[model samples]
Target: MSDIFNTSIIFKSSIFATPVYGPTTIGNMLWFFIILVLAVIIAKIVSLNLNRFLKDRVRKNDLNLITKAAYWLIFSIGFLTALPNLHVDLSGILVAGGIVGIIIGFAAQSVVANLISGIFLIFEQPLKIGDNVLIEDTLIIVEDIRIFSTIGKTFEGIYVRIPNEKIFTTTITNYVANTARRFEYAVEIRYQDDAARAIQIIEALIEDEPFCLKKPGPSVFVDELAADGVIIKTRIWAPSEVWWDIRTTMLWKIKCALEKDGMEIPFPQRTIWVNLDDGDSTPKKTIPERNHVAEVRIHTCKPSHPALEKSHPNSITAYNGPDESDKE
Candidate 1:
């Protein structure tokens, strides 16, 4: 054992000795290899645990990048620590590395900013992959989270790559982050329709739908009584995962149900009273405004006096003039 341990592989080499391990020999190489292997084993174990811990918390691509970086960082520390045993000097390398690091830092400011932002995102977790989010007024589904950027697909099927820094700094509206979400509908029913009946129908429909949450109970009430119709505001809480579907489908369902129950959405309308007593057939009330102009016919006009008709035989009896309210 002594003969094997005492044998020299590199003849006439400078003796590299440490206080604890005595003079270095060819066996130092063995120790270096052993230390390196131990480092790899430790790094692997740490990375595995980290990946498992972050499996649910972080995005897949981000986790991969994190684990790889952790593995290399641990291995590098072990490599540097072990180098001394092999009689390698690190002072010059560290100096050179410092200079290079400063240069890289200056040149890659945005990259470093993104990396830091990515790290913050991994821990903060404001949004995740598959979450529907509105960032900077653009609504999208998060497709992937990377170290430098995030990939998203818009509702229009356009793919967008957003910088991590932008994502971190901007306001993120994650629609599905919470378990439950609320949506509202402003339904205008005919002014003549029964508001109480409309509310009952809406409440019943919400109760029948499974997606609508019951604890925070739905609200159905007449919000406003406008000139055209009664505005029934309906608010409901549902699971965030199905909120959009419920919002789109439930509105139509509510409309159909109301229509079936003899309720109709009212449009703007007016009943004008003409002053037939006067010579000019001026309306006492203006007609309602609509996209298409409607012809107004005075259904009931007073008969002219026989004496006046005889006196003005060739004169214009009634003049239909435009509305004078605006002019006044």
Candidate 2:
């Protein structure tokens, strides 16, 4: 093994040694630094030129992206170019990098997954900045599309940072992805109410609303026959931005219009029947054990106890205990 190792080292040195020109290796080192500095300066100058040239059309965010990418690219190339000066073989370094990367990958598999997911998201473009979206039913606006995560502002004015992996895997409901969206609602009316008139009233209310889209007009119909009342379904198309306003305003408008049209909104109700001949409501009278050995039974119940009855206020007796003996 030692002979094999020694022979390989000797062979490697001979192959890569090449020829050290001029003085010591210091010249190569110094030259590498000079090239590195020049690269950095050129990268910055080019980035500044782009900024000034597109000053009118470019936003601060765009400029930041341009500058950042340029800086990193320049720095990376400069570092790689300096490798030969340090007497390091590129092939060896690449192989070593591969091995190290594999080892670290086992330790950070999740991180790699997230990075790949983020990359795919940038290209998919399911949602964009300045758009309102519901991710996992949590409503938020796309504040920014970043490299590793998505930044958002919730309806409650809270800032949210969601990982790219979660965003990619979870359902993304982009409200503003399309110009027109269907808003749905159900209005319940009493059984005695006029169904046709109720539908017409809701349709008219939606049509008059300016935010509602005209192409689709508005739709209203009896969608369901519910237990307490009939459910009137209404669906209307509206611009995504004004959806919340239209939804809230339409509710009040529909209810008011129905009332004005003399249509009743059903309330929860029930029916009950009482029978007097079955002895259900009437009570039996019982006298204390007294003269003439009077035998009787009284069924008295507590205010909340349902079927339990007692012979006396504080004394509990079977519901049929004394009543059966009295009959006999």
Candidate 3:
């Protein structure tokens, strides 16, 4: 028993009694450090260069996409390279990440939908920035396109954010997609006035407007006969940007020009008929009804002509006076 103990003691004392580290230990660690540092440096340079390259061409929407992808790629590579230092098993980590990623993906399916939809929007580009669009009947201007959402501005200057997924699902109308837009107005002339003359006057006035596109020729057509007069439909094509301005100013101009051309303005008229029940078997009605021709001493409205105003009817008519008219 003693001999066996002595032999075992001698063997233990003779070899590896004290532990010694070889140079390879530090070399391996240094190599790992160098590799990791080099990987990081390369990743940073690549990310920086990519950012610089894409800074101009990418829209605000693409910003998040590119940045997220770059960050994830760099982090993933760093994590993998640092696995040895952390003593973490990649196989297990990869498996766990796969499982968790799947769960997260399912849980955030709508987010994924929005992301995919936004990607589609980026590619499809149905509406560009500053486009006037009608989405599901709501007027919106494309303020910015985002990775998962679209930012819009309303006519009232209110900002609206819509998810890309929902935006893609809705119907969109782009008003400014084409260069030219149409403006139409229904012009009614008095029933007694000449229809042919009215049409020519309106067309001439429209032609005088520089904003109106002449190639389209400012059409005038006979519209429906309204209750009081003939309705003339006038349509003009103008630049999209000048639609409102042309319509507003041209409408007033057309009215004044037609009035200057002796075009009569129509007013609504209603006639009254009375049937009195009397003691006659023949329908109990008379031609005069009561046999009285009441003269409604028609005081015609003369718009206070420049020639005269009735004195003592009250006060003097308000005008700049004869000298002002002579100046004209």
Instruction: Please name the candidate that would achieve the greatest lDDT relative to the true structure.
Output: 1
TM-score of each: 0.66, 0.60, 0.57
Pick the TM-score winner.
1
lDDT at residue 74 of model 2 (Cα atoms): 81
lDDT at residue 283 of model 3 (Cα atoms): 43
Q: Model 3: runs farther than 4 Å from truth?
A: 1-100, 271-328
- lDDT per prediction? 0.80, 0.73, 0.72
What's the lDDT of the predicted structure labeled candidate 2?
A: 0.73
Stretches of candidate 1 above 4 Å error? 1-96, 279-328
Tens digits of per-residue lDDT, candidate 2, 1-328, equal 9998985566456434444654325456665787789888878887788778877886554565667678778878887877577678789989999999998789988787777887788768787787888889678888877777889999889999888888899999898889878888899997778899888778778778888888877788899989768999998898887887888888888898998887767655432132324556754443333221212123222222333333334444434433554466
Residue pairs of candidate 1 with colliding backbone atoms: none
Better of 1 and 3 by lDDT: 1
- lDDT, candidate 1, 80-125, per-residue tens: 8788777666887789989998898899999989988988987788
Model 2 TM-score, 2 decimals: 0.60
- Error (Å) of candidate 3 at residue 130 is 1.2
lDDT of 3 at 129: 77
